[model samples]
Target: MKVTEAAAQLGVSPRRVRALIADGRIRAHRVGVGWEIDGLAPSKERRALSVRSWLMLGRAVRSRALVGLSGHDRMRTAERIRRLRESDRPSRLLADWRPADAPAELYLDSLTARADRADDDYIRAALQRGPEYLRSRFDLAEVVASERAIRGESREELAERASVSARLVKNIESSQPLTSPGEVRRVLRALDIEPTALPDMVLS
Candidate 1:
């Protein structure tokens, strides 16, 4: 099938199909000026890639290499590693991967638990002040705090990176309303976190 036909079948744009081919997420061969894809082969290849991506993600997380990476870069690295793992025939398994494959959920849960612990600690501290001291608008506070902690960044260090004042970073983590919303966006960017990932209150 042609690129357009494959794109239609995959429910992705033609450009995305070309990118997948380039990334080895989809298998295709050049036929003169165009590419030829076997029917349903793309789907099978994508499924294989997904599994490989998860395996690579697990390895990266274990190594702590995923800590400071932007979400986009982390996934991209996983995909790249998957391709290398597939191509390298010297060893079937990458170093640190157990002799037996473990469920992807284990790694996912470990990462989630680490972040959750940070968020929970922040929330508990807030609750100690008073139930009424907590503001719904500051819901993003936990998110920022958790992500920053996961990245091993101090408030002062994050403020310096974001080009904001350390006091402002402290206030944001404390769930206080900021006089300048732009500072919040800056902090999020400094953490390599997308603002859209948080609650809508962040934007407001």
Candidate 2:
């Protein structure tokens, strides 16, 4: 089968097929000019990691330990990290896929260790905060921005749906308090979120 045919069968782009071949995850043979895929391999069910996990992986790639990775793997990892940083909502595949190499395994382990320490610090901080302080730190900006990105809606589109000005949506997302509670509720309702459920942290 040709690369295009194999890609179709695998439900991935031609570029992704090539990447899989390079990673030795796919079997292919060189033909006259292009390569011919033997057959489709059994697909692995990989879950996407959290945004925090992706950030940790990016950090690991930037560390001095990156020199331990193969030149090819290092270049690919750096390119992917650049794309991930530039994208507003990076693809889930970026978090799911990684090189199956010893160096990559070590990097993953390092990310896990960093995450464990961060989680512990977060728990400790939360324990020290009073109920009122915790309520006030609901992080409305983060929630609104994340939800908007997940829905793939621009500020203009969200504002239109919420029947508010785009500037108002931007202000809310930038952590600027909205004076009108009704407007805030409308925005939350447009996002299919329960306004009453969230604490009145950033909204007036």
Candidate 3:
């Protein structure tokens, strides 16, 4: 698809598509004097899509635009709330989504104003706490190590799989910090493991 079309499909502006192409994250080719995005970096695309969706939801809520929200808007808002409540939410995406053309302070100010009027204190507090609570719950290193060990993966092979140095993997097995639940979740996702599978280690 052409750059503009691809960006539109991704729900991002055309400039973002060009930037990704320029950064070599997305492959493109010139076709009839226009740039066409022929392929995408799946991981990057997923990340971008996720961030974009979160930002969109934040933007809508901050704008106080939900008072009259309907169908898609309501669904989008609910999704954002769910994701924000998720552990290791990459909460930074909220701040990162503010448009450059618009001051971030403005967006935040708007969010604060809207939040103040919200009827649900639980939702507001969750938003205020952000994703830090989730990060503190799980250790990425230990999760990765556990997954590798359980899979009968060789230490060297596991290190490569986890994209970490052998030394790091070795240390993680003994003293890894589960500082971020999100990291643990990603490791589990990679290995199709789950926290419930290790009931003995659940935080008290």
Candidate 4:
């Protein structure tokens, strides 16, 4: 079942269910594209300490133990805690598929352009992820740009051939991701790239 179903059974949000999975508070088995979410059984009480709660505890501990620290150290510690709390704001991953059992190491180190980090390398590394994580973070724009360069063609040249504006080509190369499937296919054809040649990293 999906995280939503498991959350429903456990009277929590899908986010909470994912949190439990990420923190290893619940036992979930990977099954193809989904998980066998039996861990959210009614008998379990999922009161795991979330990241936010952990930060809260840190703040409490800091406040209580402030007597021994120097003014400078106290300021630094307080600032660090504050920054961590701020950065811990809700994050949304821009990918087609994210697995419930993604490794904590990879998830934390990579998976950027998420939250406030612009970690393109992390995104690229994540392309080699397991079946449960199907999203490639693979940018078509990057491929198109690379191909155009190899063929010694400028954006304007490719645009003329593709019958689209150079500005559109530049947009495709930039951060604003291309969304139209038809446009994507057309661009691939212009670059002599096959749209069907996508990475086969789906959930096994």
What TM-score fits each model? Answer: 0.34, 0.38, 0.26, 0.29
Cα RMSD (angstroms) for every candidate in the order listed: 13.8, 12.8, 14.5, 20.0
Q: What is candidate 3's lDDT per residue for 1-204, written digit by digit as tens? A: 787677645544566567678888789998887797887555232343343454556554443223334456555554444333331322333333434444345555555344445423433453431221223222434444433533446667765665555664564455544333443444445455444432113342
The stretch of ten residues in a row with the least summed lDDT in candidate 2 is 126-135
Give the Cα error of residue 157 in candidate 3, in Å.
44
Task: lDDT for model 4, please.
Answer: 0.47
* Structure candidate 3, residue pairs in collision: 135-180, 138-178, 139-178
Residue 13 Cα positional deviation in candidate 4, in Å, after optimal superposition: 63
lDDT of 2 by residue, 1-204 (tens): 998887655545676677678888889988987889988767562344344444444443434123333345544444444333333223333334433332445545544444444343332222121211112213555556545653547899999999999997887777764577677778877865554344454433
Tens-digit lDDT string for candidate 4 (56-143): 3233233322233334544443333222222212222222122334334434423423423534344333322121221232444455
Model 1 Cα lDDT, one tens digit per residue, 1-204 = 899887766544576678778878777899998899854552433332354555555555454344344566554644433332222220112221222244546754454344334343332222121111113436567556645654556889999999999998898878775676677778877865555433324333
Off by over 4 Å in 3: 1-66, 103-204
TM-score of 3: 0.26
Clash count (model 3, backbone only): 3
lDDT over C-alpha atoms for residue 146 of model 2? 46
TM for candidate 4 is 0.29
C-alpha local distance difference test of each model = 0.54, 0.54, 0.47, 0.47
Tell me how candidate 3 scores on lDDT.
Answer: 0.47
Clashes of 4: 1
Which candidate do you rate higher for TM-score, 1 or 4?
1
